[model samples]
Target chain A: MEITIAHLYPELLNLYGDKGNIATLKWRMEQRGINVTVKEYALEDEIDFDGTDILFIGGGSEKAVRMAANRLCEIKKKFEAYADNDGVVLAVCEGFHLIGTYYKLNGEKIKCAGIIDIFAEYTPDRLIGDVLLQSSAIGSTVVGFENHCGRVEIGCYKPLGKVLYGYGNTDSAQYEGVVHQNIVGTHLHGPLLPKNPKLADYIISRALKKKYGSVTLSEIDDTLELQAHKYMADRYKNCVRKKNDDDI
Target chain B: MTKIRNSLAIVACKLLILAGRLMGKKGSSAPGSIAMKISPGVLRSLASQIKGDIIAVCGTNGKTTTNNMIDSLFSSAGKTVICNNYGANMLPGVACAFISRASITGKLNADCAALECDEASLRHIVKHVTPTKIVVTNLFRDQMDRYGEIESTAALLNEAFEKVPEAMLILNADDPLCAQFGKGRNAVYYGVSEDTGLHGEEAKDGRFCPKCGGELEYEYHHYSQLGKYKCIGCGFERPNPNYSATRVDISDGLKFVLSYKGSQHKLELNYRGFYNIYNIIASFAVYETAGGTIEEAKKVFDDYKPQLGRMETYKVGGKNVILNLAKNPAGFNQAIETVCADKKAKDILIVINDKPSDSTDISWMWDVEFEKLKSANLGRLVVSGLRKYDLGLRFKLCGFEGVVIEDISREALEGIISGNGEVCYILANYTALFETQKILKTMEDK
Candidate 1:
């Protein structure tokens, strides 16, 4: 199988080791003998997104996000077309925030790709720490870290998962992420995929299923991967239990 | 009223420090934490009583080493100086340092103080004590969860120096972020004067012009964004450093000639890693600017030994065992470069913790060039700590097999020293560093 993944703003949005997602994709596919072409599209770089099988966008600081938003405005139409064609994408943190209708910055609305109906607003209270999610799409717990200053709000769409622990969309919301067609957007970036091999495979399968009309993902030994995911998840769970017990 | 409050705060801080020591806890910051609570003016009043210059060292990396080196220069001159211990560089710790050293009469007898202040906390510290010289080592993306970005941290440091305009600023000209601070200020810049042909670090945080936000063109990088740089759009270029290290030879131990004041002085040091040269040069710049002569600095550099895991070496099983702290991506990259230089197979143990001191965010491990260590012939890979699985997964992604896992520091140390290798290298983060170091110390003692 062959997959072509296009990364947007690889330089500006290269915060929190988000590039690990692309590396994890390439690593997982190469293990299955799947050929993957990774192309980076930085600012002022022009390329048609029609043929791109999967799109990966990472998070960044507020300054980087604004720079990306300015450059991405020129390519909004091209991105909308890609989203319209049910292109597979995995966006995290501010990248996911930019996938929405608009993201608020210091009360000013900075328009994003406008592919999805979701939007995000900057919050004074940052949602940070280990996050545990019961993701319905994957039928398993998705564990990662969230260190974002903004809270996302999915407008009339099915979210990616429920917040089992830690702050999700907002401090009180149960939803952790939102899914739009083949695109998955979340704030989980403990690089998001290295520890969660299942999600890595899910994104890879989504890309293959979109391009080849069928998915054939060979299983690899995920013993260590699950161990890593459970390690953080269990720690988070115990802390939550401790907090609840203290309240009593 | 203020005098009584200050005296009470110091006496209370001293009693707590004694109590903390008796309880088997080195509570370095707790008394400072309590002192700040009792009297907010405790730091300000005590620092005012200092008889000499106070130099505040600010940077993402090398602050501890640089500040300690300055401490060495002061002691070499037989002068009393105050300093916060390693890992206690925050505002509370700065208060504790002054509180512990102050007379019960609320007066400080120290002649000088070289404080390693956290970049984010420098603004707060300056509001208390106006440093005579502000030493900015270099800025890089460290503990992003704390400051959000390097620019934000730089802005905090900028605000810090603005509060004390009379202070002579010591800046790193090689770093664009540090160099940018020199603009419209009383500042002296220090940088390396050669292109070592080495792409020092993989991650470049200072690739853009701080003034114009344009792409920066580098003539040569000493490592990770530290180099000779010129803005492509705006004509902002690297300023001529007041203190420059010419002919830096790091093939073996560090050798460099300091060029400043229209004269050159040669100095050599027994140290590993390219960044140590910057740390020492920064310390020398402060020590000299504070009134120490070149002869004094040269003497201090001759046999200067950095403690608390600045490539601290121990002999174990008749083989060399080196320990160092790798706190951030850039720091880990430099530490890895030093480790990869050895040709013989070595046991490499990496311990990672997610404490607040350790940044709690281990995502930056992906930025460290662990892949370079893959080319390094290794006898064993031992991973341990609170976030051992995260570190293990990172090394696993680098395509290494049979990673020995040990969560306990003692077991991890034993696993490495007992392995089939000619040497052992233990690299850990802030919280895990001393634990592994103490364990290795006991093992060596036995």
Candidate 2:
């Protein structure tokens, strides 16, 4: 089945090489010999979302996010329906905020998709720095950077991960990201999939399972990708230990 | 009583800054932060009460150097000047300088104040200072995480300048993006002549005009977006610069003849690269417009040196390491060009951290001309940082063979320095530069 990646505002949401998320998925899926046709839909584009399997959105500034909200509100129902039927969805950073229940910016409340229980509010201080995440579902500690002024509430429902370094939820151990079934939302950015290859393959495997049911070769690809991620993780762990020991 | 009180306040401010520095909060605006905490409206009131001219220097690159040069020029001309030479360009930093210099009654000490303002902080500070002059060096896509785009920033600057009442605007004529801001204002333009053979091609995407959305025509690019350009639709050509570097010969560090007001004199700069030449011309123009004597300008230009870790040379682990800041693709590409121009094989260590300040988005690496790194004399490339392996992948994609990756930034510097003695070029972003410098300093003590 073809993957339809609906990038909310590829131009605006792509401040942090966030477009690399979609590019990484396309290349890796093609590597697994899947017949993948990716369609990129942006704001105000008249396109049917009926056949879209996977949707992708990334990050942007507060002003850009509000501007995108006003535009995406036009097609909010279409996006909610796509995710409600278990269609794969990946929203990151500002897009993650845009897909939430409500986003408060500049003392104004803006409506979002509201499919998830996540609520985001802008703060005086900007959460801008490197972030490490420990996720139970992915079974690995992932690292990336977070640059935003808004604080997100994961609603005590479920979190994709918890922050290891930078601020995320602030209430409980810096909880990070949101994952509900086939839908995954997080702040892990840029070549986001390259750093989390297992997560990429996992999303692909789930989509395949939902569509084709119990594929063997896809599982094999998932294992290989997991090994690659584990190798990098081990190297990172070794480096951290050496650094802490002042060996450098 | 007033003198004693002013001196006490200054001492307190200095002590706070010193403590902040010792606590590893370098560039932390301690004085301003403290003053604001103590008395909020004092800084704005003091700035409004100042007698001398207020010049705000701002841009992505060269703001520190340009501010330093202009400050030095003003001081050399027998005028007391106050400036933040430590690259603290935020609101609090700007306030810190003014606060420390102010009298007990909140009156300023210096005859003039030249501040290096960050582009993002321009709107907030401009609301207070009401500057007499504004100098724009150049515009490039730096700090995507903070400032959105070239146009978004330019719009903010345009709005800020609207508040100032008839200020002398010093602009870089070569930069089409910055030059557009000089429109409908009392402006003076300064740019490098295409005489320097070092004038190379710009990054293709960053060269467009911020206004009109039309393809910008360029006579020649000094580096990145700073070049002679004109819009096709509106005939916005490079304005006949009030001050221009007529004969720029950059073969041996930057040396150029600056001509203004029917007089031409040879100007020598200690800094290298085409970018530095633009910086020199900008300083000369602003100084001359602000009533600087020729002798004072020469003395300041000759005496000034590069800031810390920006083309700063040092000895580390029995080898010579040149530490330079290369935050963006344009800057990194130019710095690599400067290193390659030395015509000697050099060992290099490059740190690429995807920190929020260093741009978590590393896609701009694809735009950098890694092909220019194929100089014959370059020996080893030790890539390290948070995204060291990713950078190594990019280098390999650019056909770099035998790249060693050490994901940890601390070891990467030591690993590269531990190698055989060779001329080394160390390139790092904002945070990594400090770490690299600290590591090299520690190595020296041993």
Candidate 3:
């Protein structure tokens, strides 16, 4: 089975290298011998969410999110079905809000996919800079930057992961993302997947199991991939962690 | 006492710039993290406390040009329009404008204050002053590092406009994102007419309309998404413009006949390219909306020459070289189209730099249609800059061969500039623009 990545709004939701996440998923899946087809869906092209395997949305300003709100509403039912069926999905920053519970974009309630129970409120102050995300599932930390004015509060559903670095909910470093079944959403933009390959490998591994019953990376490139991960993990060990007062 | 403190601040800021320039440091006008620390509301309140009209011009591109044009046009109209002409359109520049123009008694002397601001800064700027007028030139994909998506930018502008309902807005009818601000607000839309030759086929690449999730159809594209588009699903389309360009002729730079208020005014401009034509049309709309007669705008527009670097023509090494700004794909294409229309064999110099502010995320370069250059009757293309290899790779992918990829060494750059070419075109991004200018300046100096 092939995973189809939808048309990413590179101009609007690309505050960071958010598209890197899409590229990472594609490369990782291909490395495991899983076929992946990526298509470009521009503003003029028609979108059929039924054919899409996974949807990737990036971050943008609240205005940009609202501007895209009407379009998202057009594909709302199909997007929710994609998430409900345990289909693999990833949305970051503004993309996260598009698929989340509700987005308080521009001081108005815009309907999102509501796949995850998180309410995003736009704050005058933006949480801009690097962040450290500690995952209870992986028992490790991932580093990325968050440049957003919207604050997402973890409500009803289980938190995706706890924020171990920069601010998540405007003032407090709490939850960083929402993970329910196979649908994963977060605010870790930048070259997030490349910077943290474990997350990339994990998503690919899970997707492969569902597709082919079992998956395997070639033994020939095993050492190289392992070394790359160790190097990246070491590089981000302390860079994005919640800083102590003395660390300043 | 307040005036004394503000004066001290302005003088100190100016000194800092001088010192940074003297030391040859890159950040001469770098607004430190401290500037961001101050809230936009506090800043606006401070500026409003000072007497005068506050006007802001914003968009993905043309903010600098339109803001500068507004300053020039208003100044030519004999109005004291104090603006930061050096592209310091952030909070600090607004602060500096207020500090510099205010009297010793703390009262402002200007008839109006106009500033060009970045798209991201619009939200912050709105907190400070309810501008008398706001002009959005056009919105295009620019500086992806700062703004993620075009829709986000539209949302930010919409929010900013919510606070400034009293301010009259001038928008681009061709740009759906910018034109959306016209909804339920006192807004005047200015855009190029559908009469301009429309491209038969839309670009296979670029952003989609946020409303329909379908390919946004443009009646006539003026580079990128700055076109008349109507979404098939929602019927969301270009808004009716208050001031429209009846006939846009781009033989040299951008010249157009603006139809507004029952009279057509011929706007002849030295600034070449479709981008500048849009800018000129927007400026005319703003001027007409501000109660200026078409005759008054015509007199001012005719005298308006090219700014420092928008499209300054110069004689370099006995060859005519036009220096144009091409920061993004749309801007670059507009610049290329302007030169290609000349019908003369022209030598092109394209520079791309992936600096921090220039955005190391260089994926957008892939979206630029380099194949358009096939129609450009050109002698040779001298490609040089930090990302020379990337540009060379892109050209190679686009099937561009024999294009000279030279390192941006002084001797090599000068050699390319002074080479055997009838016409030279220099296209530079943010990092390389000033350096290219400095090189040109040194050549003219000799």
- In the order shown, the candidates' DockQ scores are 0.43, 0.12, 0.08
Q: What DockQ does predicted model 3 obtain? A: 0.08
The window of 10 residues in a row where model 2 chain B has the poorest summed lDDT is B201-210
Best by DockQ: 1
Number of the candidate with higher TM-score, 1 or 3: 1
Flag regions of model 1 displaced more than 4 Å.
A241-248
TM-score per model over all chains:
0.96, 0.71, 0.68
Worst 10 residues of 3 chain A by lDDT: A239-248
Q: Which of 1 and 3 is the better model by DockQ?
A: 1
Which lDDT tens digits does candidate 3 get at residues B78-129? Answer: 8888787777676566665555555434455567777887667776667766
TM-score of chain A of 2: 0.84
All candidates' lDDT scores?
A: 0.84, 0.71, 0.66
- Tens-place lDDT per residue, model 1, B225-330, is 8999999989888889888998877778888888888999887778888888788888888887877888888889887887778899888768789889988889
